[model samples]
Target chain A: MTRYKAVIQYDGSDFLGYQIQATGRTVQEEIQKALTKMHKGQKTVVNASGRTDTGVHAKGQVIHWDSPFSIPVEGYYRGLETLTPDDIAIVSVEEVAADFHARYDVSGKEYRYFVKRSPQHDPFSRHYALRYPFDLDESLMNQAARILEGEHDFTSFCSARTDRESKVRNLYAIKIMPTEDGWIFSFSGSGFLYNMVRILVGALLYVGQKKLTPAEIKVALDKKDRTALVSRTAPPQALYLWEVFYEKDNKK
Target chain B: MTRYKAVIQYDGSDFLGYQIQATGRTVQEEIQKALTKMHKGQKTVVNASGRTDTGVHAKGQVIHWDSPFSIPVEGYYRGLETLTPDDIAIVSVEEVAADFHARYDVSGKEYRYFVKRSPQHDPFSRHYALRYPFDLDESLMNQAARILEGEHDFTSFCSARTDRESKVRNLYAIKIMPTEDGWIFSFSGSGFLYNMVRILVGALLYVGQKKLTPAEIKVALDKKDRTALVSRTAPPQALYLWEVFYEKDNKK
Candidate 1:
């Protein structure tokens, strides 16, 4: 079998999610269907670095698959581009070693959350950014984001549906940059739990609104309880999987 | 009765057109529905400067309507904002003279056509731009646009369905501005016929592609025949009703 890794980009507006479900359209299902057709009805499965929730876009998601036919990289890319839907694009593809598993070899991940602070909603960009009409104190949001950085138990910032036993994860950075309309929050970490990024953004926004203090956010992180968070989870449309980082040799 | 003139914006990706038809969703129907609800079930009619085809967006389309209630400007704006769909927005509104008519009193109009020159399709901006993968000669397009400018009979660039008795219109300017990705063609004229802007764009694109010479375009315009042109009409999704102008004293 020939193993190949690929970088992918997709607009998740109409997709159920990145994973295949019992019903509804999904990014994985589309990609797999394209692969099956290329393989002449042979089943083809793909593994990704992680699954993104519904309406969460991706600019540099990574995936890998083993193919029985050893085709050129350009041929594979062209074939997938012709078969898959327009919303999902294979940015680049390359051959990889047999043991280079897409999910298992992941080292770090980066996510971005976009918020539009314009008082009037932009109809064209409604599906791409979350509109926050009210004023937000950036200094307070930055302080709260600083407190959330570093290794800690993020149970209060994770979803209740997660089955992982350990809630501990190390966050390398949390940067907030202001744009013309609003702000973009960037989070880099070793790994994230289910709904972790959305929950963290929700907590930070509460801090910016002065409803919750930075000290309160620290206390909630220490509590290690999902119910401790008072803020509602942020919507999925504004979140994006920016990029995935692997070992130096495996980087693309 | 109080007459009001309003500037509007809408994302036309899901809309059938700007006019109310026998079936399908339309921007005008949505606005009129809001007005009827505000008038307590009484039907309210609205007249726009012009009609936009299916999937054509607008940044500054103008409309006028007469209302029985003389509410404050803010009240009317807020009511419309609350009642209309998220894709439509009321940018500004004001009471206009009773003698003013939205359709007949227009002095000029501006339209913008967006073309994406990138070889790859942008998944996020699929509805906002036309992706033209082939190389284009900007100078050639500009030469053709200049020839088409000024007062001329534009029968070659007009739709056959238009019933207007005269096709002679004075075009003030046709500017081709290069953007990061592609080019934006802006047309300013006294008025345009059905699909005039799209047809002009198609003919210019043909010039840029070297499929038709600039001299041939001049000949087609002089022929005053719709079938004289070889290029197809451009798609509607990339066209925008950029702005509408009125007499200096009636400007809002």
Candidate 2:
């Protein structure tokens, strides 16, 4: 059996997230079905660095799968390109050791959320961006982002239904970059809990609107209660899984 | 009565072009309906810079409309903000002379066409871009574009159904700029014939693929026979009316 690592990009608008559900379309099921068809009755299981929710997007999502055939690494690209829908693309592929795993391997991830602050909606950008009509103070938002960095129990920012018992995680960095079009809030971390990035972005957005001060973010962090943080979640369309980094010399 | 010149932007995915059509939704009809809604019992007519085809987008389309009431220019912005659908936005509004016309007094117009050269289809970008899998020689495309500049009778490029009597027009410039993501084709012209821009882009694209040569474009121009030019019409989604330039102090 050969294991292959694939870097994928997808527009998650028409998908019910990455995982296969009983109802609705999914990215995983579509790719796995394609693989099964290509292999002629051989079942295939695919794993990803992380599972994204419905309506979310990804630019550099990484995944791995085992195949019965001894296919060249380049063949994986061409095969997936032909099999996957237009909304999904396998950007790159490489063969890995038998033990290599996409989700289990040691690594970190980065995510970005975009918000459009203009009062008038830009028809061209409406789908990919979250529209916020209120005026935002970028400096204030930047100040709030600093509080999110470092290791802490991010219970307040995580979804309440997250199955993990340990809510503590290390946040490597958080930066808010203002662009001509809008603001991009980027977060890098060892890992993220369900809806953690979206909730964190929501809290910072409130700070930018002066609904909450920079100090409020610290209070929310210290409280460690879900209700302590801002409840409004950023729209999934504006969120994107940007990259995944893994430890070198690790083979599948 | 007062007239206002408004700069508009629209996605155009759901619009049947800028003209008012009997059987389909149109940008002009939508804007007029919005205006009539705001000024109850008052009918308003809107004149646009030019008519755009179905699925063609706009970023800086200019229009002029007369109103019986003297509405503040900012109110025009706010009113449109409330009335226009999410797919349309009034970027700016300025009071203009009663004689000012959106289509007649134009000095020059700028339009852009986008082509996604990658093999992968982007779900988020499906409504706004044209994807071409074949490799295109940018240098060759630029060479063909240069030949399209200056005045010529573009009968070979215009749609057969175009209602214009004279097919001669001045093409101020045709520039193909390479962007990090895709190619940006910009055309500045005094005026354009029906389906002219799409045909021009199609021809350039064919040249880029080595199917046609720059010299062939010159030959097509010289022939002036509609059948002499390439028949493939570029998709409308990739085209955008970026700007309409008029003389300053022209009171428009």
Candidate 3:
């Protein structure tokens, strides 16, 4: 069996998430279904870089799967185009090492969260941005974002349902940019917990509204307690998994 | 009774068109419904600058409505917010003279048509731009567009369903801009016939594909024959009623 890695882009509007669930269509199920069809009815399991919550879009999601029969990398791209749904596209496919793993080999990730501050109804922007009528102060939000970089116990910024052994993660950088409709908060990190990026963005948004100060965010991080956080989790529609990075030299 | 001239913006996805049809929701119908609710069972009629085809969006569509009540202009803005649907917005409203008309008194109109050439899936741009898979030659299209400017018989570039007395119209400018994903063609003119803009854009796209020449477009205009045109009509979703211009002194 040959292993192949594929880069994916999808609109998460109708997807439950990246993982399998009891009900609702998911990104994972759709890709696996397509693979099974291409493999002549034999089931094929695919692994992804990470799981994105419902309504979260992706541009450069990475996945790897073993093919039951040998096929050219270009064959996958040409074949999947006819099989995948309108909202999903196979960006690129490449032959990978037999032991390559999509999820375990990931080294870093980048995510973007868009917020539309304008009250005007822009039908086009509504699909990609979370519209917030409440005013936001950019300087305060930027200050809070800067303080979020580096290793920290992100327990306060993760979903309460998470039960990881350790809540520590390394954040490489955070960039806040003012867009035409509103602002986009970009996060690059070694790893993120469940709902971690959304929670981190929500906290900065609170700072922008002047409800919480930069010092308050620092204190919340030091406490490492979810209950001590003042920011509510942001919605899922505006969040996007921009890219997933993997080390080339770390071949299995 | 007080006459109010309102600037409107609406998404045309759920709308049949700007005109009242036998069934299905229209932009005019939605605004009229909102007004009827504000007037407490009093049916309201709104006259618009012009009608847009089904699935055509608008940003600065002007309309005039005579109200049974003499309400404050500011109050109308606040009141209409709750009455209007999520996809529609009353951008501005002001009291106008009783003699002022939205349709006949118009000076000029600006229409924007977007064409997305890339095949990649961008969920955000999908709502506003029409996707075209074939390659387009920018210079050939621009040359054809320049020849289309000036007063001429536009019968070949109008919907055959139209029954206007005169087909002669003056075009002020035609600007073709290449965007990141594709191209946007902007047209400014004294007035446009039924489906004139879309038909004109369709002809230009054919030129970009090397199916026709700029000289052939001029010949089609000279013939004033609808059957002389070879390009197919463009879709409505990519067409936007950008703005309506009026004399500054014509204010009511």
**Candidate 2 lDDT over residue span B69-185, tens digit each:** 878988888988788887898899999888888889898999999988777666667778788888789899888888889999999998989878999999999988877777888
Model 3 lDDT tens row, B80-160:
766877778888999988888899889999999999997655555565788888889999988888889998889999988
lDDT of 3 by residue, A1-252 (tens): 889999998888779988878898998998899999999999999899999888899988999999878888889998876788877888989988888888998999999998988866666555578888888898888888778899999988898899997999999999988877688889999999999998998898889889999999999988988988978998898899999998865333
Give the per-residue lDDT of model 1 (tens digit) for A71-169: 889988999898999898889999988888888999999999999998887788888898998778999999998888999988889999999999999
Candidate 2: residue pairs that collide: A97-A252, A98-A252, A99-A252, A100-A252
lDDT measured at residue B98 in model 3 versus the true structure, 0 to 100: 85
The TM-score ranking, best first, is: 1, 3, 2
Candidate 3 clash pair list: none
Better of 2 and 3 by TM-score: 3
Query: Highest TM-score, which number?
Result: 1
lDDT of 2 at A148: 84
Candidate 3 residue-wise lDDT at A79:
82
Give, for candidate 2 chain A, the lowest lDDT window spanning 10 residues.
A243-252
Model 2 C-alpha lDDT per residue in residues A128-244, reported as the tens digit of each score: 789888978988988887778999999999999998999999999998888886789899999999999999988888898899999988998999999997648888988999999
Q: What does the lDDT read for residue A178 in candidate 3?
A: 84
| Candidate 1 per-residue C-alpha lDDT over B14-74 given as tens digits, one digit per residue, 9 for 90 to 100 | 9999999999999999999999999889899999999999999999999999889877889
Docking class of 2: medium
Interface RMSD of each: 1.0, 2.3, 2.2
**Candidate 1 regions off by >4 Å?**
none
Candidate that would win on lDDT: 1
